[model samples]
Target: MTTTQGLGELTAAERFRSRPLTRLQRIQRLLHKHPEISPLVVLVIASFAFQLASDRFLTASNMSLILQQVSIIGALAVGQTLVILTAGIDLSVGALMIFVSMVMGSLAGNVGLPGALALLVGFAIGMLAGLINGVLVAVVRLPPFITTLGTLSVFTALALLMSHGTSIQGDDLGSVLTFTSVPVAIGPFQLTVGVILMIAMYLALGYCLNWTSWGRHVYAVGSDEDASRLAGVRTRRVLLSVYVAAGLLVALSAWVLIGRNNAATTSAAVDANLDSITAVVIGGTSLFGGRGRLTGTFIGALTVGVFRNGLSLARVDVLYQTLAIGILIIAAVALDQWIRRTGAQR
Candidate 1:
């Protein structure tokens, strides 16, 4: 009787140990290991679905348009991604971009400053704005949401004041300002300098995030600021640098924005603050921070562009397109929550 019991216990233990993961478990594991996979899969599926709905959806011309449309938001999202990876948010992204672009436009068009000089001034102002936000968040220890919310209002006012409620046309802004609008043809695809610049930013930031010590510290800070501090990471300096870096990118995007619109208006990209955040979240970057890829962010921005363009091609109503995007945002957040919970339990 004892021998039989021992054999049965051994069999039961072995079976339990050898149990295969269920499909859901496998999916969770995959997402945990590679958060971008979910968004990439979604992008592919959505593209195919849209293509089926409209034969024109997959055409080179239409595809190029989508890329063009996404470039501004994609660039903004790169900065947003860095801030988010540090477990912070910036509501002032759009406002800051507008303010910088307005400054650039005004200097170039009204003050007769050389376009190159105006751009350099814009960059300096952008870094200054970022520095302010960083100081508030890192030194003053203000909550990011509150800090940026306050700055958003401030930056918007500054842009309006600077522009005097007017726009600077590309003609007055000169070749340097409009350079990003110049188009390039690559095989079947038509692309802009702005698009190429956005891609380059992604590649550079992706490398920094994945392969550098600074990148690891960023993840660590986002994952647990207190723990990171305990581990000897200068959490405050990291936070400060992130905001400053974000500011530089914001300035870069402002240049792109000028080219894309063929003008710099305070009104341009008004919806970008939320749109950038939406792209970041949808790209599989955890809102809670410390987990995400730049590739996912690009995919997320492309996904939004695809959805809108595809839906328009399908003759879907604008309201429904907005609704679809809302649904995507909620779904992405929910998935992130689930992944976090499951990982904790394991």
Candidate 2:
């Protein structure tokens, strides 16, 4: 055969080689395409491992308790996910929640406002906090980290000032403020309105992120802000909106906090900012941005609860649990780096 014909025939044969990939290869490709899958797998494995380690870990009542414990953190993580998706971070989310809750407490309990009005005011405060962060980051061109860090201190101080460092607890709190504690049974599990609210937020956000044009723009901005701007995306507007949305979520978390803690304490959710960020990272949301899923965040929140609950059931100390969480955070980041490298190589 002529050299050209021989080469062409060989190329045709190569194209016709339709061997299927092995199961491991298929799994790796699937994981690469969907970063959230790894976290889900980890969550399931952790649950099973905990179940084996402790008899109480697998009980329906214990699972319900875990959900309740994670609900507030999960709510905060929702907003955190949006900020991180835009290649931004908000250290002020927990502080925002506390400040808003304090507003709710002061308005309803001290100022004699109706419970409903107090709730609205609380939401407004949360939105305002978000707006400040947005303006600083999007309009003033400040780094998100710096903006939120500054706002974190500001919001915390505001909460303390507003509450005077005292928790609001009295008959003055209306049914609206206490509604989060009202429980309803679902099959074998009992759940509170707060937990339901947390789940609903995830469902709504999952749809928004996966299906909306705005969501696409968010990912685009995170992936490459300059390119997204060149493609006619309103990068600043998107960033602002994301921050605002995150603020709204934080307010909702405050509401849940009231329901969970049964009081609007200034110290409520003090660790939420770190916990939310940890859940985002461990849930397989890329800290570098442009890749993640709310479902993963949901699982990540549950995973944290599981770890704490399981460890307690297993007779581990609180200090050890904290250390374990720290270790998990480091391991998750390491895994994230490995996944990114492998995907890049692929």
Candidate 3:
């Protein structure tokens, strides 16, 4: 063949040798094209399946419960999402949350501080904890994982130490919890304030991630820390802010948790940081960083709720329920990795 014909023949052979993209491949390609839609699909599927599996799964009361359940992880996931967006993780979020809750309970319940003042102090303490993480990670040049892991131990120990490992009683709920528990009727459906807040927070963060400059900076940083810095994105400042945001959200999550339960346990939020990370990953956030959607995280929290609730309905042993969560965590992280690989290839 002539040189041009040879080249053309090589191209044709390569094309012929290549496996045609299958339905799944094509779907992945499409999903890679629009990251936001992927989570929506997951949410839809979970909602539909839950609706089918149990008549009570999607009922107004059950839905309210779902909101409360998702709100804890969902609120905390907001911060986790922000941190992950910057390609960082905060193992201290759960610990910090416990510490904050204990502080609040101690201040208002044991120390006789005004409810409002105690709440503010609790949030501030949480923010301060986040600030410490930001400084350690950004200014002190510590790796986020190590710094947060240390803080996780330190903070949780502090919580236990401060309260002498004692459980706090039924302290009054914070505004976040009270508001979330309030019922609202809209046509045929009723929702607590917490559900609305979750929806609002999700929508706001989703927009901020997609539309705002600061949010864009987070994605850019997560996408490429080096490139983001080279682009003058103020990497340290962004990281600092991300942790602070996460801390604040953790405080909010604590409020919701305490509100729904009307108490605080030294043990309950122990694995929250781990669980929050799980939700974020399950929602499709790339642990490797640079790609994820909040909606998926939203659904992820709900997916977790459904799984837990479903297990309850199925009468699984409590130990098995924990085992199932462990399994799901692994599966979610695996799926996230797979999605990341597929996205990278595309």
What stretches of model 3 exceed 4 Å from their correct place? 1-22, 35-53, 171-190, 342-346
Tens digit of per-residue lDDT, candidate 3, span 28-110: 77666555465566567766765676777777677666666666677778888888878888788887877887888777777
Q: Which of candidates 1 and 2 is the stronger one according to TM-score?
A: 1
Q: lDDT tens digits, residues 1-346, model 2?
A: 2234444455654444444556865676776578778878888898898889887888889999999999999999999999998889999999889999889989999998999999998888888889889999999999999999999999999989888899988466789997887896999899999999999999998888989999999999998899999999999999999998999999999999999989889876788889999999888888888877888888888888888999889889999999988988898888777667745644
Highest-scoring model, lDDT: 1
**What ordering of candidates by lDDT runs from best to worst?**
1, 2, 3
In model 1, where is the ten-residue run with the lowest total lDDT? 1-10
After superposition on all CA atoms, what RMSD does each candidate show versus the true structure? 3.9, 3.8, 4.1
Candidates in descending TM-score order: 1, 2, 3
Model 1 bad stretches (over 4 Å): 1-20
Q: Estimate every model's Cα lDDT from 0 to 1.
A: 0.93, 0.88, 0.75
Candidate 3, residue 317: Cα displacement in angstroms equals: 3.1
Looking at candidate 2, the ten consecutive residues that score lowest on lDDT are 1-10
Q: What is the lDDT of candidate 3?
A: 0.75
True-structure lDDT of candidate 2: 0.88
Model 1 C-alpha lDDT per residue in residues 117-228, reported as the tens digit of each score: 9999999999999999999999999999999999999999999987889999999999998899999998899999999989999998899999999999999999999999
